[model samples]
Structures are given as C-alpha cells and as structure tokens.
Target chain A: MTATLTRQAPQHAPDAAATLAASTPSWSRRAKNRAASAAVVAAVALTAVPLALVIWAAVERGSARLDLTLFTHSMRGVVGQGGGLLHALTGTLIITGATAIISIPLGLAAAIYLTEYAGGNKLAAITRRAVDIMVSIPSIVAGLAAYALFSLILGPGTRSGLAGAVALAMIMIPVVVRSSEEVLRLVPADLREAGLALGSPRWRVIRKIVLPTALPGLTAGAVLGVARVIGETAPLLLVAGFTDAMNYNLADGRMATLPVFIYTQWSSKGLDTAAYDQRAWAGALVLMAVVVVLQLAARALPPQIAKLRRNR
Target chain B: MMAAASAVALVLVGVLVFLAVNGGPAVTAGEGELPAHAKNFLALAGPLAFGSLWVAVIALALASLPAVGVALAATIYAPSPRFGRFLGAVLDLLAAVPSVVFGLWGLMVLAPAVVPGYEWAHAHLGWLPFFSGEPSVTGRTVLTAGMVVAVMILPIMAAICRESFALTPPALIEAAYALGATRWEMVRAAVLPVARSGIVAGGMLGLGRALGETMAVAMVLSATPSLISFNVISAENPSTIAAFIASTFPESTGAEVSALIGLGLVLFAISLVVSLVGRRIAKQGGLR
Candidate 1:
C-alpha cells in the first residue's frame, strides 16, 4: 500500500501541474461538464416524453371536436353527435367515493390497532404482513374475487355499481392501511409519552394527537387510493355492468364508469365511434386531471398546515 | 385490536376462498365441457404468462437503468436545487399519471410509432419463431408492452433507490472520497450495497404492478393468438390472464361466466402468492 501510495503521489503532482496549466483555459472543462450534464438532462427528458405524449393525445382527441354536452348530457344515442360523460363521471364518483368511505375507516381502525394497541404482538405482526400482501394483490384479481363472491350471492346474472364499489374497496384498503400505519408510526414516541404523561387515555392520544399529526399523510394516501381506484376498469368490468344511460342505483343493474366506457367504446362497434372515442379521451383526461389536482392539493396541504400551525 | 387485525387478514383470505370454491369448480367443469378448448387456452395461457413475466423482467431492467441513473444524477450531479426540484416534480407527475391514460397513449401514439420499427425487425428477423406473427398496426409487441411496463414502474424503482441513496449518511460518502474513491466507486461500494435491498423491494413492487396490470396490457397487446413466439414483430395478441378475464367475463353466461371467473381465480391465486412472497422478501431484505 505504501509503495502504491508513493507512486500515485508523484503522478498526482504531475497531473495537478497539468490541471493548473490547463486551468487558465476554462472552456474545455466547462464544455465537458456541460456536455455530461446535458446528457443527464436528456435522459431525464426521455422519461418525460411518454407523459408528454399522453398529454398531447388527451388534448388532441378530447378538444378537436370538444363541446359542453359531453359533460352535460348522458351517453344517449345521439348519432354522430358528442354527448357529455355524465354516466361515467357519476359512476366514477359514486364508486370511488363509496370505496373511500368503506376503506378509510376500516384501514384507520386496523392501523390504530396495529400501531397504538397491538405493539409487536404476533397477531399485529401477522396483520402487518397481511396488509403488505394485500397491497400487492392486483386490482384485477380483486375485481374477479368480487365478481366471484357478488355473483355467487346475488345470482347467475347480476352486475351492479355496488359490486364495482366493493372491488375498489378491496384495492383501497391495503393502501390506506399501509400509508396510515406509516404516518401513525411517524408520530414520535415522545408525543405519545407526553400524552400518556398528561394522563390522557390511549384512544384519546391516538384520536387527538397522532391522527392530526398523521392527517396529511393519511389524506395523501386516500387521495392516491382514489386516483388508483378511479382508473380501474378490470374490476369494474367484472362487477359493474356497463350502462349507456345514467344510472344512480349502485345496488342494482348496470352503471357506466369512464374507464369501462373507454374500454367499451374502443372494443365495441361504430356507435358514433369518433364521438365515443372523444368522450373516452375526455373522460380519461378529466380523470387524470382530477387525480393530479388532488395530489397537488395533498402535497400542498402539509406545508400550508405547518405554516398555519406555526402562525398559531 | 387482534380481532380487527384478524378481520383485515380474513378479508384477504375470504377473497382467496371465494376464488377457490368458485373458480375451482368452474375449472373442473371446464375440463369436462370444453376439454379441447380448455387445453388450447391453457397452452396459450402458459406461454403468454411466461412471456408476460419475461416482458416484465426486461421492462423492469430498462426502467431501472435510467431511473437509477437519473436518480443518482439528481442526488449527486445536479447543478442546483432548482434543477433538482424541477426533476423531482417531473417524476412526481410521471408517477401521478393514471395507468389507463398510459394505456390510451400507448395504443394511440406509441404503438403506431413502434409498428415501423417492428416491421424492420420482422423483415430482418423473419427466421425467429417469436418474431413471426403478422405485422401489428403498431409496435404493440411484447417488447413494447415490456417497455411500457418499464415506464410504468420507473417512478417506484427510482423513488425507492433515491431514498436509499439519500439515507446513506453524507459522512460515509466523504470518508470514501477522502480515501481516494471516485464518485462512481463511492456509489458502488457505499451507496449501492446499502440501498440494494430497497432497490429490490422497489423492483419487486414494480414487478407486482406489471404482472397484475389490466388496462395497459388490455390496451397494448393484440391478444389473439394462443401460440407463443419469439418474434417481436408478430401481430399476434399476447394475452395476460387479467386481459382474458376482463374481455370475457361480461359476455359469459351461466357456467361460461363461472369458467371465466375460474380463470380470474387462477390469476388471483398466482398474483396473491407472488405478492405475498414479494412482501416477505422486501421485508427481509435478504434478496440484496
């Protein structure tokens, strides 16, 4: 090692001398570094290309013959004329909202049990593992499972928006549980200790202290879950029967969702093909926009809340 | 608390049980009703499943390469905080985009652009079995699907890797630099090993998504042929299990629906097992 170091030190001096000599002309190093940096930037830009393409396509397909009726009117047979995505929009909202309602409380309760009450008990660990596994189960399988159960229970020929909600609920639960657990865990032991020291009960500490601290993350998780479930078509395809007209009832009959509408239009025949395609694009664009807006809101909330907390 | 946890566990188990009892009977009935069709379908399914997995592995590899590179660049070589933030926001948007949107774009734009390249491959590599399918309208081959899968999974792998890199204490990096390690060497020896498990976890997470993805696969693949081929340009549809169930289930009547449900059950069973294993491996960090 010494011998190698001795040899390297002499070489380093010569290299330093050359660098010093070349340092007078800054253009060469700067150019090289710039080129290298540009390459990295180019690579990152390539990643954005697909996204650019999607945005471009959405705009092109959605706005070429865009109109208000596409959002205002239902998917009635209006010949070649465009109709608004009321059916799909309504279905997506109803199903996703229902899923959120069902999953949030269940996941929150489970997280509370795991983090606050269960500690490291064998059951808690097992539940944690189960939650982890559940998160990985593909949304499609959840849909299928929902189909198997719902169909079996309801009858041979049964499809409803409620089934879609159930399928989405399955997908949402794991994500909410995992995200909520992480957030709850992030609540410092000190905070919990302080709460305990104040003689507050465990449930009170969790409900008041930990949940508020974790609220931002929990909200973010829920928004993400909504985003995920909103685009889901496979499960909806299996469980939620496709409908052309607006259907408010989730418990019975068919309902249309943006995703399933897209799939149906693309797969089915020329029933105002271009118009249907436009609606599909519009639906997708709106869905993506909603998700982006929600995510931004979720991201912005923490800083805004933190600032508010500081001001108080 | 235990009871609630048990409830969560039971929900998952219930899903499996439902599939088993329902799908199992359907599969058995299928063997009797349409044995030949079932055999053909299974033959098709086996290869397609493996092909899909292969596509996923390749896609993951491609996705991880640039993702890791960009992540490293953002962390180490970024010129300024503004640049870093911009890069981060871009990635966030990329991650946030819905999968259906990706599928739609893939079908409309990427597929068309890809078709010509695929034609070239077909013209050149006509001798290959896999590449022997009819020319698709676009480059909607397994390769493209794989590439799309890579893109879809990039954010996840990159995020995990980036976090792991960030977690490596700056002190360790300085120590390596002081010891005369190059930037690349420092990353390899210090950052890479430390983050290896996290990276795998991220990759597995992405793999899970790829295996189970519905819209993307449904939109992208032609999915007509039961025969598997090595040809990348073949227009033959490479169907995934998810695609099969989605397309068939709605139209299925009586036992036919049950049969489709059975196929879905198989898919669920496979995915559930894979996901469970993925979680275990990720938690153990042994794969690193």
Candidate 2:
C-alpha cells in the first residue's frame, strides 16, 4: 500500500514540483532581464536628452540673433554688426584643402603598398605597426611637432596657416592609410587575379581593377579623415595663431580657422558674450553640417563608383 | 624608392626637430603660474589631470552599461527590424557628430538643465563628498564633462558589442534552444562568454578617446580648478591636460608653456600606449 501511494505521488506531485522549479528560474531571469533592459533604456534616454537640448538651444538662440553681418562683415567693433566670418570660412577651406592635398596621395600610396604589393611581409608589418602608433598620437602632439619643425626653419614665434595644415596632415595620414588599407584589402583576390590572368602587370591590375572596386570604401575613409582633421582645435591653436581678418596665404601670417575663432570668442570674454557665443554655436553647427555632408557623400559613393567600375 | 622613403623620413625629422627647439627648454623648468609657497616640481601637484581622468573613467564605465544593454537587446531580442535599423543609424550619426558640438551643447543646454537637480543633491546629500559643493558657476562640473565623454564614446562601444552578439554562431544558439534554454539562459551561457573579449576592446577604445579629447572637455569644464576635488557641483573649475593645453597654449609664457607642452607629450604617450594595447587585445578577440 505504501509503494502504491509512493508511485501515485511520484506521478502527480513530483511532476508539478519539477515543472514549477524549472519555470521558476526562467521567471526570475525574466524579471532581471526586464530590469536590465529598463536601465539601458533609461541611460540612453539620459544621453539623448542633453543632446536634444543643445540642438534646441542652438536653434533658439541662433535664429533670434543671427544675421547677414555675422557672415558678411568682420568683427569691426560695431554694436551688433561685427561683419561676416567670411575670412574664417575662407581660412578653414584653404587650410583643410592643403591638408588633403598633402595627405591623400601619400596615404593612398602607403595603403596600396601595404595591401596590394607587400604581401604581408615583415617590412609591411612593421609599417602597419608604425601607422597604428601614429594613429594614437594626440592631435596636440602633432601640432607641437609641426610647431617644432616650422619654428626652427622660420625662427621663433612663427605661426602660420601652412604650419597648421602640415600638422593636420600628419594626423590625417595615419587615419587615411589605415582606413584605405582596410578597404583595399576587402577587395577580393579573385578580382586582382582575374586582371593579372589577362596578362596585366601588378600595377595595371591595381589601377584598372582593385582600386575601382574599392573606391567607395576608400572614399569613406577619406571622408572620415577629413572630418577628423577639420574639427581639431588644439593643434591648430598651437600652430596657427588667431587673426581677426582671415589670411588666405597658408605660408604667411595669422590665418583664422573656425575652431580657433570659436576658441578665441569663448575664452577671450570680449564684450557682448552673446554675439561671440552665437558665433561659436554657428561655427560648430557649420562644422557639424560639413561632417554630415561628408558622411552623405561617402554613403553616396558606392553606387556611383560601382557604376563607373562596371563601365570600365 | 630611396628618395621617397627619405622624404617620409624628412617629415619625421622635421617633426622631432620642431618640438625639440620650441618645447625643450620649457620642459626642464617649472611652467604655468606656480602656487605661492610651492617650491619644487612636486608642489606643482594639482588635482587637474587626476580630476579629468577620474571623470573620464567614471563616465565611460557608467555609459558602457547602457551601451552594452542596448546592443544586447537589439541583437538577442530581435527588436523589430525597422527599429533596429533606426537605432543603428542614429548611433552611427551620434558617433560622427564632432566633439566640439557636444561641448557646446553641454555648455548651453545641459549645464542649465542640471542646475536644479544639482541643488537638490547638494541640499539632501550634502554629507556625501561627491554631491557636496556650491553649485558651479554655469552648472558645468565633473558630471557634465563625464556625460559628454560618455556620449562621445557610447556609439563605438555599442557597435562593437552588437557585432560580437551577431557573430555568436547560430549553431550554439540553436543547441541552447533545443535544450529548452530560454532566451536569457542561452545568452548568459553561450552568447556573452563568446563575446566578452570584443566588449572589453570596445570599452578600451572608448576610454582612450575620452582621455585624449580636447575641445569638448575645454568647452564644458570649468577650467579654473587646480585640485582633485570630487565635488561635481563645486563652483571651482576643474581642468584636464587637453583643456589645459587648448586654453593656455596661446597665452602661456616661458617655462609655463614648455611645461604645458610636456603635459601634452604625456597625454600623447598615454593615448598611444592605450591604443596599442587595445589593438592587441582586440586582435586576440578579447574586447568588442
């Protein structure tokens, strides 16, 4: 009778208890997971709130105060009409253009050599390691390095737009080289082999085949590099001294870039803090807009480049 | 070929030469305005760099939790495909936003918004060292700086973790499911263990960026504080090496400027070592 009772109990009570225990762990786990999820959602919300507030502030303050004089006239000590940032804008474009010119060819060549020609040799590996080191060097160090070199050549107290561009170019090279190499390596060996099989030389195969296929990725890297250098403030401040009126010549006296201008406006505490603050915000917005444009351009590249590649 | 290599070599030489000539003499001497009655280099010890790095570490660690969470949720739960895509794009755009803009936002928006909360914390939690202080002049404090740094680093960390989750071999996930393992069980047992390394790597990179960033820190922090005071709401300005460089380079005189440059060098060396180590760990599949 005892055995019979035990068997009956095993079938009913044991099954229920086992089920409850098995399900218990999951229920508790579910509760923990929900809490974790809520915490993350809260954190992300926290991050986003401040960012949204900033954009709102910029729009509110900017619209209320921005005018043509901010863009057209130089800061002429007028009550409200400190002319345009025309000079600053010009200085920024010219200096950045110079940086691109200096960095792109050198970086692209370095990338091509590393990815296509070196075949992962010891030398290539060392070069890659050096590039990695260079990437982490602070922007200010690059500026100081540039300042060191340019000051020796031009004598003490020599700060020029060219000096800043050169400093920026140093920073730009490692980024471009690393990104371009990665993108170029992503082009399958088959494409290159196919080109070589046609009796094309290695250089020709690279130019005619690999480069075209990887153009979109390479362009994206370049866009990122451009964005990185354009926003750099410390290096520019160290190398390019500020000027009220923008000088277009990179090799000559003070040229004002947007970053430096913003720094000066914020730090100098000149009369009319509002105007200076507005200019700074406007400058930042313009810089961000440029980055957005570059990203859009980068995103647009694959389709256009793919079509071109196919035609070739 | 030799000429090309030499040209590259020349650029490197120029860089070294320039820094030496302009920055050498200054490093050997005391730079910046020294505190009165402070005699030696050791006396120059202020809480500035310590404060900056402390804030950075705290912020990144705090920020990483949410970042990893979102990545996990988006990956494991299979959030609606559209929502996933939207969040991914938004995060990427956030990553692309410049640091200076983040600083500007902190100054104009976050500072004012947090003032009331800061006051409340000071009123209630005044005994706690972290919350004890007169509210800052502009509400720009260690907390605001940390938040900005956290925001700047979040997208990269999230992306790294998300990729790690994606790469969790489907076969393992399937096997866990077959054993009647729930979604959470499978993730805990199979997914996270496989992806731990990637997450750490992502976190390290974020930390490195936080440490080296100049503009945002300069714009957001009160640059006047010279000590390692932990009070986030202190009226005193806290300074970091990067901010110190940006704000003082133009106006510094004699040894003061050189010392700042030395600090810049130190900052550079720190970032370099971090990146190299981070890269190795990343290669080993340790960090996301």
Candidate 3:
C-alpha cells in the first residue's frame, strides 16, 4: 500500500487554461487565489514539519554511537558498555526474508488469478474487495491472527521467529496482492492476445508474455511490500517475544527484531539509561535507513528496468 | 491460483474467526482477569471501545481540515505539477516512517514540547469539562496521543483526497472559471462537488487507522483502565483497546489472554465496520 507513492494515477490531464488564468486574473480573483494558496501551503508545511523533525531526531541521536560494535555483538546479558544488535539484525533479516518468501508467490498467484482468469467474476470481485480491505487491517490484528493460529496448532505459549514471520506475512500478502494486481493490469492486452494467437494456452500466455512484460513492476511492488512491513514492531513484538541473545532458528525461542529492539531498549531501561536510549536511537536509524532504501528502490528501479527492457 | 486467491480470502475471515474461536471461552466464562474498571466483558470492552473511537474521532477532527488543505494544495493550488508531486512524495515519507519511531519521538520530544501549551489550555479553558484537569505533568495525555495519531493518518486521508481531487474534470474547473467564479468559489463548485465522497471515505479510512493504531498510543498515553477520558489532557486518561491489548498480552495467562483476545476481536469488529463502510463509499465515489 505504501507503493502508492510511485504508482499514482496514470491520467494527468494538462489544463493549459489554468496557467493562463492565473497570469491574467482579475484583481479580486487573484487575491482570493493567493490567500487560498497560502492556506494550503501552510497545511503542507504543517504536515511536512513533523516528518522533518522525526528524521532529524533519528539521524542526530542515532549517529552518536553507531559503530562496528552495533553490528558485531549481541546485547545478551550485558548491562550497557559492550553490546550490539547482531541478534536483532539477523532476526529481522531472517523473519522478513521468510515473510517475503511466503507472501510473494501466494500474492503473485492471487494477482494472476484476478487478472487472467477471474475477469469480472463475482467471486473474484468479492475476493479482490476482501484483499483490498485486508490491506487496511490493523498490523496488530495480523499479530493476533498469527498468534491465535500458532497457539491453536502448537498449544499455548508458542513463541518463535516463524510465528513472527507468519504475522508479518499476513500483513505483507495483501500489500503484495494489491500492488501486483496494479502492475499486472498495466500489461498490454495485445501482448496477451498475440500470445494466444500463437497457439499458446492461457496459462502459457500469462507465464511467458504477461509475466515477462510486468516483471520489473512486479519486483518493485514486492520490494515495496517488504518495505511496508519491515519496520513493523507491533506484530513481531506480539508473536515473537524479544530476546537479548542471538537466535537464528525460526522455530526456536524468542527472537529480536530491529524495531522491537528499539522498543524494548527504551521500555526496559537499565542502570545506564543513556546507553539504552542510544541503542534504541541507533536501531531506529538503522531500520529507517533500510526502509528508505527499499522505498527509493521501489520507486526508482521499475522505470530503469522498463527502460532497459525497452532499449533491449 | 484459485487456492491463492482463496488464501487471501480466508485470511480475512480467519482474523475474525480465530478471534471468536479463541476468545469465546472468555466471554462464556464472562468473569476472569480483566482491568480494574471492568466487572464483565461489556464493562471491560465498552469503555475501551469508546475510548478508541473517541480518540480516533478527535484525531479525525484534527486532521480533516488540514488534510483537505493538503489535497487542495497538491491538486489545485500548486504553482507547478512538479511541485505537487514532490509535495505528495514528502507526505508519503511520513507514512513510511514506522509508528515506533513516531512513538519514541512523541514520548521523548513531542510530549515535553507541548506541556506549556497544555498548561495554558487547562488554565484558560478550565471551566470546560474536557479541559478542566490540571495538565498532565509528563504531558503524556489522550490529547497528545490524539495529536500523534492525527499526524499519522494525515497522509492517508490526503492521499485519497488528492487522488479524487486530481480527477476533477479540467473542463469543469475551466467552466467554473469561465462563469467568473473566484478561485475558492470554483474549487467549491467543481473540485469539492467531485471529491466530497472521497473526503468522507478518506475520513472513514483514517478513522479506521486511528482506531486500530497501537504503538503511538501504547508508548505515549499515560492511560489506565478507566471509563473514557472526559478530560483528555488529564493524567487519568482512558486506554484504548489496541493499546490495552498490546500492554497486556505479553504477560497474560489463560483466561486473561483470552480476554485480551476478546478485546482485540472487539477492536477488529469496530475497525472492520469502519473500513467496510469506507470501501463502500470509495466504490460509490469510484476511487481506486
């Protein structure tokens, strides 16, 4: 859903008269226009100010002690002086990688079903609507859903990185579906028609022609889906309780994530409160860096890849 | 493919079904470890649900005017199209930042930053029940949480409104201008008429988000298990269901966990209703 920044509506109607009127407007109309513009600009400032502040805070506070040690040592049983987020870094990567693994294919298949086979089918529409609604469901609900499902299957108190990954996957799936559907819809119908004319079956056409044509966009969409979920603290904190030590096994005991690490570091303060605060800020900084990079890639890569395809 | 689509469909149902299946025992037992204020399920849920909706209402109210202003700036008021798109992207950055960061910022930076303002409001508007209490010494109040959620949802509402606003027929705008309408009047006649449903739908969606939002409220508000906060700036603020569940679920045992599940299910139901209605409105408005 955060992919929307890159995927705005395709239709941009250029209105020439709009430019001309502003230049030669009547005095009263010009004054009114100026006032309204000023108000809207103020609103934009109001919204942007908070973002600038948060990013500034994250960068300023986080860079103080961000060093090799943060990535080298796990914060296992150390009070403050010597510790790192090796455990959290591995845990977040593993869980999110697993989340992507699980959600991407299921989402791709659902997108293909909706685009190629379902057509205007009623069940398809309901299914599509369901997916759309699911996009806005609370992230915590996903955590609860995963928690309930796993607890039922594994009995009470089943906490694992796998459960956390599953929770994140639940959130990511709908996002992947929505973005994949958007990109899939952009494939030229004539391409599919040509494939069909070449005696290929429908599935063959989708697999060969449609998928290749929309490959870059699909990748971008998947990346954006991951970006959306990577910083999720609520769900992971819910299903995968935090641990200080390194735990690589998905089905093993509680695992730490960067976001949850940031949360826990602040809440469970130690004797050295400043150390904990610095760790939290550094974690936030690292997490923000990853999210921003993924976001930029999601926005920038598709067009470049499309251009490459075109040049080829 | 069918199975994949069904998986998506199933998850939507599974969220509700699991909440019901796991939480049913708690409701049947109807007497377990709940918050100090709650004697039964309804007592536990009623105030929490109300608090959640009320806080979201405050947030929506706070956000709607500025959100529309943002949509208008991006769609009709920008000097150039490039500027509008840039502004939109900047807004999206707000959405991309995780809520935990916002929570930490709220608790650390924003809460203290607004203490003087809260004291001023409490001093001036002390006669009003809603502003009567001595301002929270720590500045972590329902009002502060509302401000945080308002900022969080502003972009969502603005994005939806920007989509619909951009779709306003250029011909309609030109026609209004041709009829000698002032800039504000033209926007009122053309853009507002076209994007009204979008504004309403966006508000509902934002409300849905604000209601279910957990981290900011959990980390910011100094809330207790109480009836709804009549005085939003008071330290004795009410906890939202989502925040309550987040704080409670970590250590909860047997019936208590089930009760938290029940609370979450109630949250699910309320937010589900809001989002479904939002979807219905968006469909009616023909927003994608």
Identify the superior model by TM-score, candidate 1 or candidate 3.
3
Off by over 4 Å in 1: A1-39, A304-312, B1-3, B30-36, B40-44, B124-134, B179-182, B284-288
Every candidate's TM-score, chain A alone: 0.85, 0.86, 0.88
TM-score between model 1 and native: 0.88
**Model 2, A180-286: lDDT tens per residue?**
88788778777888889989999999888888788888888898788778877878888888888758788998888877766766666567777777777777666
Listed in order, each prediction's TM-score against the native is 0.88, 0.88, 0.93
Candidate 2 ranges with C-alpha deviation above 4 Å: A1-26, A76-82, A303-312, B1-22, B30-46, B78-82, B286-288
Ranking by TM-score: 3, 1, 2
Between which residue pairs do clashes occur in model 3?
Answer: none
RMSD of each: 5.1, 6.5, 5.8
**For residues B1-288, what per-residue lDDT tens digits would candidate 3 score against the true structure?**
988998889888887788788887767555446645367888888888888987899899989988999989888988899989798888877888989998999998899999999899999999998889688989999889999999999999999999999889988997898777778879989999999999999999999999989988899988886667678888888989888888778888777878888888888788989998997898899897
Better of 2 and 3 by lDDT: 3
DockQ, all models: 0.52, 0.40, 0.62
True lDDT of residue B146, candidate 2: 85
